[model samples]
Each structure stands twice: as C-alpha cells, then as structure tokens.
Target: MGTPHSRRGNTRQRIQDVALGLFSERGYEKTSLREIAEKLEVTKAALYYHFKTKEDIVISLSQDLCGPIDELIAWAGTQPRTLATKQEVIRRYSESLRASEPFFRFMQENQAAVRDLAIGDSFKERMHALFGLLREPEAELTDQVRCITALFSMHAGMFALQDVEGDPEEKRKAILEVATELVTAANPPNRRPVRPDSAQTASP
Candidate 1:
C-alpha cells in the first residue's frame, strides 16, 4: 500500500487531471468544482480536501504546467548566451510545451477566462523572462522579432498542426526545426562560437 502522503499526492494529481479534462470539455466558466468531483467519482468534501474552488484547481494546474518552464528559464540563465544555447532553449521549450499540451489547449480555447485568471499575468511574465534570455539587448529590431517569433512558433504549431495529418511527434520536430532556424537567424554570425573543426578547416 502507498504511504498516506503518497496517496494524498496521487489524489491531488487525479483531481488536477480530471479538472483539466472537464474544463476543456465543458468550458472553464461552465465547469464547477462539484462537476469535477462527480467525474472523479469522489465526494465534494473529498475534492475540497484538495482544491477548495474551481479557480484553485486551475491555478494548481497552471503551476504544475509552468514549473518546468520556470526551471528552464533558470537553467538558461546559468548558460553562456550563444546560438547553441538559444537553440537548446527552443528545443527544451518545445518538449515542455508537449508535456503540458492540455493546459495550453485550455488556455487557447478559453481565452477570455484565461485572461481573467491570475495565471495569465504569471504566464506572460515568464514569457518575458524567456524572451530576455533569448535576445541580446543590443540586437537589432529584426533580430529581436525573430527571437520572439521563434517562441511564438512553438505555441502556434502545437494547435495549428492539430487538424493536419501527421504523427504528433513528427509535427513537434518540424515545429522545433522552424523555431531553431528562427533563433539561429536571430543570432548573428559574429556572435556564434567557432567550432574547432571549422576553425581547423579554415587554417592555411
């Protein structure tokens, strides 16, 4: 048997998953805490032990989805700012988005509700931090736009490619490729580190 703490953690995750599904299906505004508890086959009191309100559930879900992003931002901050690092950021970001697709879908489908929620501002703040990490302060306007577009491409590709026929992983790869290209273009040749092999080949 699982320990009491482990069991409680499982219950909390279950509540988050079921709540997101209900929120997606019925719309965040229409979905209630009671409905989520009913879907989970648990009592409202039991659900209350985990989340007191629908907004609380959404906030918890947001935190869970955004946690990896926060970590990525911190990780990027510690790395040297280079084209290679920026591309890796794009790759890792795409993976993070893949893991949290459902939460993102909810945000896309329920724009008004998401805007009204506190997570909206929080999410935007994280994006700004990420953008700062990707773009140089002295970079040209066009290059800066490329960095921003690189990030936007990932989000757009997730939903935009849904109706198209292709493997999901393949689509993600294609999106990552485009995002990588954008960031690479944004980074000038002067800024990219010279590979040892390239340097050797160029030697007389």
Candidate 2:
C-alpha cells in the first residue's frame, strides 16, 4: 500500500492530467472544477484539497513545464559560449517539452484563455530567454532565423507531426534531429587555416 504522502502526490498528478485533457477537449473556459472532480471520480472536497481553482490547475501545469526550462536557462548562463552548448540546450529543451506536448495543444486551442491567464506571458518570457541562449549577438540575420526556426520547429512538431506515420518517440527524434541541425548550422565551427610546413626542405 502506498503511504499517505504518495497517495496525495498521485492524486495531484491525476488531477492535473485530467484537467489538462478536459481543458483541451472542451476549452478552458467551458471546463469546470466540478467536471474535473467528476472525471477523476473524486469528491469536490478532495479536488479542492489539491487545487483551489481552475486557474490554479493551469498555473501548476505551466510551472511544471517551465521549471526545467528555467533550470536550463540558468545552466546555459554559466556555460562558456560554444556550439556544443547551444546544441545541448536545444536537445535538453526538446526533452523538457516531451511531457508538455498536451499543454502545448491546450495553449493552441485556448489562445484567448491562455492570454487571459499568466501562463502565456510566463511561457513567452522563457521562450525568449531560450532564444537568447541559442543565438549569438553578432549572428547574421539568416543565422538568427535558423536559431528561431529550430525552436519553433520543435513547437510545431508536437502538433504538425500528429498526422504523420511512425512511433511518437521516432517522430520526436526526427524533430530533434532537424532542430539540432539548425542549431549547428546557426553556429558552425570556426575553421582554422593550416600553416605552411617550415621544415619541408628534406621532402623537397
């Protein structure tokens, strides 16, 4: 049997999962806390014990999505500016969003509700921070586009690849591959010219 604390944790995650699905299906404004409780087969009192309101649920979910991104941003800030770091940032960002794909869909379908809530603004700020880390200050316009495109491609892939065939993980990898390629293209390695041989007299 699970401990009381584990049970409470499970209930909270279950609530979040159901609420996100309900929000995605019926739109955030149309979904109610009662409906969420009913869907979870839990009493309203039980639901209230975890989340007080619909807005709170959304905020919790958004925070879950942003937490890792915030960590990534902080880590990137301390790293030396290099191509490998940018690629790893892209890679980690992709991994972070894997579990939040449904949240992305919710945001897409409920743009007005998202705008009304703080989630949109907070998410945008994180995205901007990620973009800043992806591109250098003196990058050319085309390179800048590459960096932005890489991020958006991952965003787009969650929905865009829905109709495509193959495993979800495979599709995710494909998207990551493309995004990584874009990042690499945006930050190509510097090529050092080869120095002429100074002691080639014997060879000649």
Candidate 3:
C-alpha cells in the first residue's frame, strides 16, 4: 500500500485536476463543488475534506504555482545580478509556466474572478520581485521595458501559440529564444555575449 502522505497528495491533485477541467468547460462562477464532486464520482464530503470551497481550490492552485516562483526569487536573491542570472531566471520561469497553460486560460476567461480573488495582486507582486532581479534600478525606461516584455512574451506565448499547430516544446524554445534575445539586447555591449546554445540547455 502507498504511504498515507502519497495517498493524500493523490487525492488533492485529483481534486485540483477535476476542478480545473470543470472551471475551463463551465465558467469558474458556474462550476460548483457539488458538480466537481459528482464529476469525480466522489462524495461531496470527500471533496470537502480536501477543499472547503471553490476559492480554496483556486488558492491552492495559485499557491502551487507561486511556490516555485517564490523559490526562484529566493534563489536569485543569493546570486549576483548578472545577465546570466537574469537568463536563468527567465529559463526557470518558462519552465514553471509550462504546465500552467490550463490555469492561464482560466485566468484569461475569469479576469473579474481573478481580480476579486486577489490572485492578480499576488502574481503582480511576484513579477515585481522578478523584475527587480532582471534589471538594475538605474536602468533606463526602454531597457526596463525590454526586461518586462521578455517575461511577458514567455507568459503570453503558451496561450497565444496554443493553436498555431507545431511541436509544443519547439514553440516554447522559440519563445524562450526571443525572450532571451530581448534581455541580452537590453544589456550593455560591455557585458558578456549570450551563448548560442543557451536555449538548448535553458531548462535542462
């Protein structure tokens, strides 16, 4: 038999996966806990044991996504603020966002719900922290835009390119390439040049 810890984790992940599917098919507001439980073929009581409410479900999902970003921020904090560090930040961030395409779609469709839940505020704070790591305080406005745009390109690419009809991993690499170029170009020429093979080992 599996450990109790693994069993509990499986149940929570199942609930989250089912809830996200319902949220995407039906609007977030329209999807109910009873509906989620019914679809899972599990009892309402069982669902409640894991998630008390729909907001709780979203909070749990957001926390899972934010945890890595928070760790990335903490990791970046210890490293010197160089272009390589910034590139690693972009790489790790792209990796973090890869599995969150469904969540991104939910956020896009439920902007009002996202705002009401304060998910937007929490995500914005993390972006600000990342921006701090990507650019120096004294950087010019254009360079600042470059850094922000680079991050945004990676975030937007997953959603924007979903329908483009090609290999998903390749698309991610292409997007990462563009974002990396933006950051590299934003840096001074005196800085070391970015390696051409950086994208291959970017997430590795």
Q: Against the true structure, whose TM-score is highest?
A: 1
lDDT computed for candidate 1? 0.86
TM-score for predicted model 1 compared with the true structure: 0.88
Clashing pairs in 3: none
TM-score, every prediction? 0.88, 0.85, 0.85
Worst 10 residues of 1 by lDDT: 1-10
What lDDT does each candidate get? Answer: 0.86, 0.85, 0.82
TM-score of 2: 0.85
Which is the winner by TM-score between candidate 1 and candidate 3?
1
Model 1, position 29: C-alpha lDDT score: 95
Query: Whose lDDT is greatest here?
Result: 1
How many residue pairs clash (N, CA or C atoms closer than 3 angstroms) in each of the candidate models, in the order given?
Answer: 0, 0, 0
Name the runs in model 2 displaced over 4 angstroms: 1-9, 191-204
